[model samples]
Target: MGTIEYTGNHHAFRDKLRRYLDEAVAPHGEAWEQAGIVPLSAWKEMGEKGYLCTWVPQAYGGRGLDFLYSVIIMEEMAHIGESGFMVSLHSDVVVPYLFTYGSEEIRNQFLPGCVSGDIVAAVAMTEPDAGSDLASMVSTFREEEDCFVLEGSKTFISNGINCGVVIVAARDSLEEEPYNAISLFVVEAGTPGFEKGGKLQKMGLRSQDTAELFFNNCRIPKANLLGQRGSGFIMLMEKLQQERLVCAVSALAGAETLVEQTTKKARECIYGSGMPLIKAQEVRFALVEMTAHLKMARAFVNDLVNQHAAGANVVVETSMAKFLTTDFLNDFSRRSMDLLGEAALDDDDVFAKALRDGRVMPIFAGTNEIMKEIAARFMGL
Candidate 1:
């Protein structure tokens, strides 16, 4: 019901994805919600079918396809409004960091399993006091005789409870600048001192397992370092282009869904009055305006993705896309709910979920404020 679900960009690919969602994911969504996490089998099922990282190279167990396949995955996620799921983030956002920047040995050790769903991964960057401001982060790492000691905690991490492997950002004690001093390390699930706190109950994305991750005297091999020392900040900046683009796509998709669902609810409400919302001038005008805005954002995101595959730095475009789309989604959510009146307040209905989910759209990936800063800088303001 969200924005035209498929733009006919890749017909055959879209069809395959539609089939997978109907056959595999949709049926288990509600159960996953109740369980607080998705079964690992779902990841394995997606990987086995070449859906986990459709754009990953064959050397890493993927189909070696175009980025469009990755877009297909994000698009499908929107169709089901599965914001609680981390598949798009795992497949496109985090995995590409390894594929693009991890040492060959590290890639060899993890990428295949990642592509095949044998391992689920997460990246920890936000600390309790340093959200959106990496400069304030205090997580520290020190070199030992043969390993590194990591001591820090990260909050509001996605997939925190279920990640089998985590990339942790730790500040290097030897460096003078906190943000520049940061480094990334790979930590496996059962590392002695690495533990997950309870799932964080949020206003939205409650099923997504956001949680606090603790690393107290946690030690991993020097070989676990993701890139050069003092490079984690640079690394985060480099990879966030894709991350923000994925966010933008997800936002647009979700907004479109909200509009669709709300339109239906409006129709249902107007039954006695006898006019579909589309038939009312005011409602029709709002729909047309929002549709145009979403369509423009969608087209911009598609082009950004294409540029990203061509190795262009899309940081500015990504910021714009994420900020604008998320804001629009939030507005659309409110307007749609308002249009639905009391019906939207139903606990059992899609409108309730849409309202809740859309609220978080502007907050994650970096708040809309941060996005505006990035966008402003890009505009030479």
Candidate 2:
């Protein structure tokens, strides 16, 4: 809907992915939710199909696709109505750190596996006390003769249980300043002293494998450090724009699916005098209003996607889009539930699931409140 032109290749890719999800992912959505985690096989299949890390260079065994391919994946995954698979988190958010900052040896060791889906990736940044304010993290690392010792725990880490490798952010124990004290390291799952806690029971996004990760004197070779020492904060800041944009894209797509489902319900649900719910003025007005909001959000987010693909600095705009679309998603889901009344009460109701999943959108990828603060600071308000 924005200025980006979709080539025939892009259209073909989207069509193929849509079919694959219907066959491979959509059917397992309920089972994954019940299991509290998407199975490793599902991730491998996604990787095998080249749907994971499409932007990775061909040198790393990726298709070397552009950012638009990523957008297509996010949109289609949202349409399938399963938030737990977290392909975008692995492919776009976490892998970029490894590709951009990891040393050549590190890239060679992990990038192919990541692209092939043999390894799932995660980023460990949030702690029990530190959510959006990363400078407050208490995790510490100290450099030894040839390795670094890490000590601390991270909670609410997505893919904690299933990740083969995690990018751990910890501060230098000897450094006093918070911002400059931080650094990132690639810690494999089975490394001694690195413990992944049990899956967390969450209010929503139940299938997502969120858990606590403990690093008790975890040691890794000096080569595992991503980027320069004490550059974790800078690296994180540089990549946050894309992370938030991914959230915005997913939120908007989820909202679109919800509205489409609810509108269809409205057209079929019988009202007084045996007329459809859409015949009622109240129902019609609600659907109309939701559609109007979605159209506006679509335009805004699509523009941001194009800007992001072109490598423009749209941090302020992306932050705004993230909060706005997620807020609308939650609002629209709630209204759909109300408008549909008893019809939306099933255990597997699409509207109900949307409501539960949408609640967390504003909280993650930096909270909606943090998004506002960022926008205000950048706007000099």
Best by lDDT: 2
Please give the lDDT score at residue 194 for candidate 1. 96
lDDT values for all models: 0.82, 0.94
Tell me the tens digit of each residue's lDDT in model 1 across 1-381. Answer: 123333464677788888888888877767777777777888888788878877777886778877777887887788887778889889987888788778889888899999999888888988989888888888899999999999989998898988888889889888887867989889989998899999888777756878899999998999999889898999998888888888888888888887777666666665456766557777767777888887787778777877876789878888988989889988887787776667778764676776777787777778889999988887889
TM-score of each: 0.94, 0.99
lDDT of 2: 0.94
**What shift in Å separates residue 177 of candidate 1 from its native position after superposition?**
1.3
Candidate 2 Cα errors over 4 Å, as ranges: none
Candidate 1 global lDDT: 0.82
lDDT of 1 at 118: 89
Off by over 4 Å in 1: 1-9, 274-278
Candidate 1 residue 187 Cα shift, in angstroms, is 0.8
